[model samples]
Every structure is written in C-alpha cells, then in structure tokens.
Target: MRTIAKLENVSKTYKLADDQQLEVLSQINLDVQEGEFIALLGQSGCGKSTILRIMSGLIKPTSGTAYQYDEKLQGINETISIVFQSFALYPWLTVYENVRIGLIKRQLSSSQEEQEITEAIRLIGLGGHENAYPKELSGGMRQRVGFARALVAKPEILAMDEPFSALDVLTAQNLRAEVIDLWKNKEGTFKSAFMVTHNISEAVSMASKIMILSSHPGRIVHVIENKMPYPRNEKSPAFLALVDEIHGLITTLNLPDTPKEHPISKAIFENAESKAFENIPYVQISRILGFLEVLKDDNGRTKIFELAAKMKEEFGSVISIAKAVEILNFIETPGQDVVLTELGRKFIEAESTNQKLIFRKQLVLMKLFRLIIDKLTTLKTLAEDDLKVEINNRFPYENADKMVDTIVDWGRYGEIFEFNADLKVFTQFEDSV
Candidate 1:
C-alpha cells in the first residue's frame, strides 16, 4: 500500500504560560494510504485534534516530523482543507461568499472562482441556499456551508474534527452518508481524508481503518482494519463481531487485573428445564434483592440483609448493592427477590457469572454446535466483571444472553443444581442447592 501521509514518531508538548509543560502526544506513528479513510478515536485530551492541526499545517509537532507526499510533483503542493466542530464560517459572510473565500485568495479569475464556489456548494447539498447567511441556517445546514468552504479549497487532504457532533442524530447520519459517497466518487482525486471522533459507531461506519489511542500521555494502542464492505450494517453479525473484538481489546487496556475465576459444575444444572415468564419486572426484582441483602438468615447461614448492608457501606445504596449482587448473582431476584432457599447460596458459591469463562464456552459451543446441530451455545459461566462485559457486548444483538440468564435464574430458583465455573471445567456438589 502506498502511504500518502506519515507521522514518524511525532510528539507534541505544550509549554504553558507558567512554564509548566504538558506532554500531550508521545511517540505517535501513523500512516495514511492514498484514498484511505482513517478515524482517530480516543477519550478527550488524547491529542487527536492536535494531530489533525499538525497535519493541516496550523501547528508544528514538538518533536519528530510529519510528511505528506505530492503525487503530481506540483509546485510546492497546495493547502489542506479543515472542518471543525464549530463550523468556523464568518457570520457576516453569505454562504456563497464563505465558500468562495479560499478560492478568491488564490488569485483565481472571477468567473473561475465563482464556478468553483458554485460547484462546491452544489456538491455539499447547499446549492440553492448560497445566499443564506450562517445565522439563518440550521446546525446541519451551517455545517454543510463549512464543508463547502473546505471543499472549495481543493485541498489534497480533507481533515475533520468532530464536524457533525453538534447536529441531531438523523442529520449527522445523513451527512456522514453524503461524505462517504463524496469520498468514493472522488477516489484518487480526493487522495485521503482523516477524521477524529469519540463515537465508535461513526468510526466503524466511515473509516477503512480505526486507530484507538490510550489516554494519559496519549499514544496509539490498537489499529483495527474494518474489512466489511460499505454501506456497513451496524446490526450484521460480522459488524457486531468486529465491534465486540474492538471492545474486548479496549477493555483489556483499561483494566489490567486478572479476573477472579469461577467455573461451573455441570451437576449444578443436571435437571434443567426451560420455562418463560412474560410479566417479569426488573425494578421489582431489584427491590427484592435489595431487601434480601438487608435481611439476616435466621439459621446463622448469612442473611442477604447483612450482604445488603455490606454492599451499601462499600457501594453506597440498597439499589446499587442489589444491582452489584445481581451482577454477581450473590443474590438472585427474578423480577422479585425470593428467599435464597438454599439454591441461591449454591449458585453464588459456584461463581456462575464469570464473563470470560462464559464467552470462551460460547466460542467453543458455537464452533461445536456449528459443526453439529447448528445450535447456539446454551451453557455459559460468568463472574461479576464478565456479566458487565457481556451486557455491553451483547447489547442490540441476538439477546442470547437472555437464555444464558434464564439458565442462571433457574439455578437461583432451585430448578437446577449444577455450577460450571471458569469455562465449563467441572461439575461440583452444591452444598446449599
């Protein structure tokens, strides 16, 4: 692949007025190929915008160098167009004048300059509104004016900094589609475009490549190649798989602790049966768990109430305590917290909610099922952290988790006695179940 722009070990350090230096970017190396769409993604203060500014020639890199290739060997190259979140147009200038500003400055003749401005306005879907001023336009329309002005510059690289963040969802999505279409049609001519956004879905939809940066002296951490073809489907299994993979990578970076392992024993659920309840309410169940944690066991077997008080002391309230217990299944309330009744204690001791174990089992079962009955995995082991991760990864997809959850819920209700801990390794005796 031909690299059109390269940032070789670039670092940007800002020396404040008080002489306190802040190192924003450290040892950043990135390459953009000709005609490639790349997205820079990270939390705030990750130096994403700083990189864009450096690329636009508006700021200099504190250390190392950034280079852009000129294919035509043109006379010292030309300007790089930039679009910002602010839309940056002069309020006094009409949309037509704003779009014409860059071209006019290049000493172009009147007719040619007007034609360029007209074409750019038309290209960005603002053709008939050229005479409209920025103050009169909606957020989306004003952004289009900014886009038109940038396009009119005819820059070799188009760099945007959260340009659509201010618009409503539908409008931003529409504009994103338009931008992608513009890029595809102008392949070779447009050369390359770079965007910095915090939205994961935006990066997935628009870019050929997505680079994630780690915060605190921001540095590139992971580069994911989005191989799916456009237009991409946010719901497709392939899309979700990629999203989950990226999520897994990102999550691993933020938390380095080795998770507690709790594998399940098949004997815990040896007599499982499927039953569905349609009228379950999560809030009622959450309250029951909350109250249960506050109640002490009469037999000195450890009351959920004691658990609740401990949770409250550590985590703050009955609700959050109940929720945390819900995550770990230290207490089970299916739409209402019923007494532990022995089985609940059994499930908790088994640590049946470990997510990594569950995910690993799901992977294994998926491969096995595909090779056998074309069935989805049913057996899953999850811990507190895994449950949180699963909820995030499985959101808006398959809802397979509901079934895994049903299995756990059944175990909590004393319908089963098996506990599979740490990825289906064993079947242990449940003293309580």
Candidate 2:
C-alpha cells in the first residue's frame, strides 16, 4: 500500500512565559495510506488535532517530521484539505461562494470553477441552496457547506477535526453516512480520509484503522485495524467485541501523573506536598454533584447518552462532567454506563451537613486540591498573582490559569481556604467539625 502521508517520531511543545514548556505531542508517529481511513482517538487535549494539523502542514512539529507524498510538509500541503469541527464558513459568502472558495486559486476557467462548485454542492446534498448564506442555513446545511468546500478543492485527502462533534445526533449520523458513501463509491478525488474523534463507536463505524493515544504529551499506544467489511453491522457480535476491546484500552489507560498506581511510587503519593503541580481539569463541582445525584436516583447505572437526555444536557458536555466525576472516583464506568460509587451514593443520601463533609473529604483527597491547601497552610496567605506564578513554573500559561480557577472554586466549596476577592489572596479556613 502506498503511503499518502507520514509522521516520523513527531513531537510538539509550547513555550510558556518565564521559559517554562508544555509538551503536548511526544515522539508520536502515524501514517495515512493510499486508501485507508484512519481515526485518531483519545481524550481531549491529547494532541489529536495537533496531529491533524501536522499532517495537513498547518503547523510544523517541534521535532521529527511530517511528510506528504514522501516530501516534507511545511505549511499547507496542496494534497490535503481540512474540514473544521466548527463548520468554518464565511458569513459574508453564499453557499456557492463558500464552496467555490477552495477552488478559486485553481487554473480552471470561470465556467469550470462554477461547474465544479455547483457539482460539489450537489454531491454533498446541498443542491438548490447555492444562493443561501451560511447564517440562513441550518446547522446541518452549514456543515454540508463545509464538506462541499473541502471536496471542491479536489484534494487527495480530507483531514477532519471532530467534524461531526458539534452537530445533533441524527445530523452527525446522516453526514457520516453521506461521506462514507462517497468514499465507498470513489465519487470524488478523496482517495483517503483521517479524522480526530473521542467517540469509539464513530471510529469503528467510519475508519478502517483506529489509533489510540495516551494522555498528556500524546503518544500512540496502539493501532487497531477494523477488518470488518464496510456497511458492517453495528449490532453484530464482532462489532460489539471490537467496541469493548477499545473501551478497555481507554478505561485502563495510564495517566502520566498518577504515580500512586506503582509500588515504587508509593513514597511520592504519600507526600502531599510533593505533588504541587497536579493537572486540574476544568469541570465545575456543581456538575459533578448534579451527576452524582442523578446516578444515585437512577439505581447508580445508566447509559451516557440516556443520562444526557434525562438531564436535558448536550452529550459532549455530559461526557466532560462524567470524566471529572470519574477522575474524583465518585463514579465507575464499565463502558459508557456510569455507576455511582459507594462514596457517590453516600454524598447523595447524606443530609445537607453530611453532604458538605463528604464533599470536603473528597476535595482534600484530590492531589490538586490538597496542594493548594498545603501552599496556603505554609504561607498563611498568598496573593492570586503569587499563586499563579507558582503554578506557571509547572504548567503552560493557559493551563495554569485553569488550574488556578479549579483550586479556587473547589477549595471554596471544601472550606479548605478563604479567598478575599478584592485582595486576591487565599488564606487558610478556620477549624471546624
């Protein structure tokens, strides 16, 4: 099989203020073959999009190499085009114009350009909406425009960044079906496609191969091939087994900073003051509490999507909340079904005062939370700027901001510390209970 694109030991790092560095992509490698559709799967912030960007030549890797057609890819390779997750279409442009944008620089005549644009729109099922502007179109229609634009370029490869993530379920499904049909039929210049997504079922449904990535400083842990035939039965035993296999890969994936999982690392885990730079997630405590209550009432088990529907929340948002809750050990998930833990159930069943106690205990157990308490205890009080400076030494600037917020918000809930907003200082809370 001919290789269409390749990344050889690629790595990426972002330099933060004061000479600190945040490594996003490690010595990872990937390839897009002549006719294979690959799905790069991992948690958010795992550098999935960074890999896509490197393949598309939108950004250069800090080390190693990204190549297309055996040539080094520097900035914007001509053989690849991207379909963004946000449906990035120009508001000032009509459907015709939006689809026509990619083909504008081609050497084709005006008539040829118009013909190609019209046919591209028709192929993506956006026929007769040529004159419609993006603002006038539905979400599905807008994304069709995005697909149309990428197709009109007549590129050999399409790089999609969670293209269907922002759409409704039916719409995403419909669009995925349409694209698969095109790939199956060899309808366009699209010889291959690769995309980044967090959804396992979507990966199994779409790609011929799936690359699983490890968290924080992304590295490819395994590449599983989907050998099942196209139009494969999602309900088939084989398909279910594949899903379960990949799901296991994720659930048991080791986090880089989780030193407690190893015997020799026990010393590090015991020293609360040593782990001062725990990577804190951006989830709100309220969502964690809310999900716990819902799970408890629902017999402590429910499908992820079912929970989302019951709570009238978006699927992706609920997943983020679930991840946060999972990290704190309040929930255990065998697959997509989240089961509340014994602690989770206790939190829900306890009286108001007892609930506070439970919440506080859980917060203190968190490495990030405990770190903040440790700092405040030692310093008596520290201004937010000083705390942020302390954080900047460990994390990238943007992530440092989030870690700061997580400590402040969760710390306040635990009453582990008191914050004076005007002074921007955090002080230890008075003893109680």
Candidate 3:
C-alpha cells in the first residue's frame, strides 16, 4: 500500500496570553496508507481534529513535517477532502451548490463538474436532495451531503471528523453501513479514509487500524489492528473482546497513577503541583454523584463501558465524570473497571451535610483548589475576572472562563467558598472566613 499522508514527529503548541504556551500534540507520528481506514480515538480536546487538519494541509504543525504523497505539504492538499462533524453546509445554498464548493479550486469545465457532482450525489444516496436547502434535510441527510461534498472531488483521502456523531443512532448506523459499502465497492475512487471519533464501537465497526491517544498534550499511546471480517458482529466474542481490550487501554491511559512509562503519566506525576496545571474535567458535581450512585447500584464495581451504557451516556461524558471523581480520590479505574474507593463509599453513604464536608476536604487537598482557598483567605475575596486570569496563566491551553465556572460550582457545592454571581465575586465561606 502507498502512504498518502504522514506526520513525522509532529508537535503543535499554541501561544496564549502572557507568553504561555499550550502544547496540544507532542511528538506525534502517524501515516495514512492507501486502502486503509484509520480511526483516531481519544477523549475530547485531545487534538484528534488537529491531526486531520495537519493531514489535509489546512494547518501547519508548530514543529515536524507533514507530507502528502512523499512530498512536504505546504498549503491545502488538493487530493484530501474533509467531512466536518457539524455538516458545515451553507444554509442559503442548495445541496448541489454546497457540494460544488468542493471542486471550487479544480479547473473542471462546467460539464465535467456537473457530472462529478451528480455522480457523487448518487453514490452518497442524495440524488433528489440536490435542489433542497440544508434546512430541508434531516440530520442524516445533511451528513450525507457532507459525504457527497467530500467525495465529489475524487480525493485520494477522505477525512471525517465525527461524521455520524450528530445523527440519531439508527441513522448513524445506517450511514456507517453505507459508507463501508461504498468504500468496499468503489475501490479506486478513494484510496484511504481517516476518521476522528470518540465512540469505540464506531471505530471497531469501521476502521482497519485504530490509534488511541492520551489527553493533555495528546500522544499516540496504543494502536490496534482489526483483522475481523467486514459486517462485524458486535455481539460476537471476538468483537466484544476487542472492544473490552481497547476500553482497558483507554481507561488505563486516562488514570493518573497507571504507570510512569508513558509521557502522559510522567507529565501528570512528575511534579507535586502538577494537578494545579491539569485541566479539571468540566463535569458537574451532580453528574459525578449520580455516576457514583449508579456504580453503587452495581455493587460498587463495574466496567466503565457498562456504566456508560447504563447511564445512556456517551463514552466521553462518562469518562469525564469518572475523571472528575478520580481526581477527588473517590474512584479508582483499574483496567476497564471503575471501582468505588472507600472514600467514595463514605461520600455515598454520608448525609447531605456530611457529603459536603467530605467534598470540601477533598477540594482542600487539591493544589488548584488550595491555591484558591489560600488566596481567598488572604484577600478575603477574589473577583471572578481575576480568578479567570490566574487560571489562564496557570493552564493557558484550557478555557479559563469555563474552568472558573466549574470551580465556582464545585466550590459552592462543597461549601468551600461562596460565589456572588450578581457581584461576580468568589469569597471564602463564612465558617472558613
């Protein structure tokens, strides 16, 4: 197979205010080969979409080289087209017009362009929708137009960023099947496809190769090859086993104390104050409590995947909640199973007031919260804007406003501090004061 796109030791960093740099991708290396369907799977904000951008030559890496067809990629690669997660269709334009934009740079004559667009629309099952505006289409149909637009250019690589994520489950399933069928039947049209997804099952169902990334300066930690025959049986032992294995790998990688061998774990544990810089999962306290209650109902032990299914939540949301709980030392995710810690059991068993006390104690133990508490102690109160600025200075890569909001919510819930939303200030709790 020919290598179509490659990233060689690429690392991407964005400069934030006050000379702070936020590293997103670290020493990443990967390739997209002809006839390959590759899935990049990781938690949200792990720079998966950034990788696609690099491959399509939409953006340049801060360091390292991006190549297409063995040549250094400069501007946008003409042979690579992307289907965005949001459908990215113009509301004012009809489906045909939207797809025609893909060929905007190509020097095709009017007749040639029409023939290509028509063929792409037919192939993607959007034949009659060409004249309809985006508002007239269902979510699935909109995504089909996204596919048609991407396929219209006859690109060698079709890159999709969570293509089916916005659709209903049934629609997503049908679209997945159709895409796989198209890939299998229309061999020479597109040599390879690369997808960014959070859904393990989706990756397992489609990709021939799956690359798993670690969050916070995303790095490729594990890669698995799926040799399972097409039309994979989700319930089959082999399929379930692969899913379980990938779940274990992802869970282990996300945990704080899994092992120091990986860069993620090293970056997490190398400093005592590292937690201060870590981006706290922006999950609400109620969700964390709710997840714990669900786990308790399952005898305080269950696989993370099972918990996600039980909650009827996406894997990423469940993992975010788990990470929040884990940061408080209330849970321990060992392999694929999330076991409620002793502290967690106490929190669950405690009354509302006692639960608040426990949560407060945990908050006091974290460096980030402790920093806030110390500042509030000395300063009597902290302005929300000031806190946001401090958080930005500390974790420049994260959304400061969102972090401040989450901090206030968690703090208020734990009685660690009181926030005056009207005044836009955070003050120490009266008892602490």
Which candidate number would show the highest TM-score if scored against the true structure? Answer: 3
Q: Flag regions of model 2 displaced more than 4 Å.
A: 254-279, 301-339, 365-371, 385-398, 420-423, 430-433
Give one digit per residue, the lDDT tens place, for model 3 in 112-227: 99999999999988988889999999999999999998888888888999999899999999999988888877732888899999999999999999999887678998999999
Kindly give the stretch of ten consecutive residues in candidate 3 with the minimal lDDT sum: 256-265
Please give the CA lDDT of all the candidate structures.
0.60, 0.80, 0.86
TM-score of each: 0.58, 0.86, 0.90
Candidate 3, superposed: residue stretches over 4 Å from native:
256-279, 349-351, 382-402, 420-425
In model 3, what lDDT does residue 392 have?
66
Q: After aligning candidate 1 to the native by TM-score, how far in Å is the CA of 21 from where it should be? A: 2.2
User: Alpha carbon lDDT of residue 202, candidate 2?
Assistant: 88
Q: Candidate 2 has which clashing residue pairs, if any?
A: none
Please tell me which predicted candidate would have the highest lDDT against the true structure. 3
Which has the better TM-score: candidate 1, or candidate 2? 2
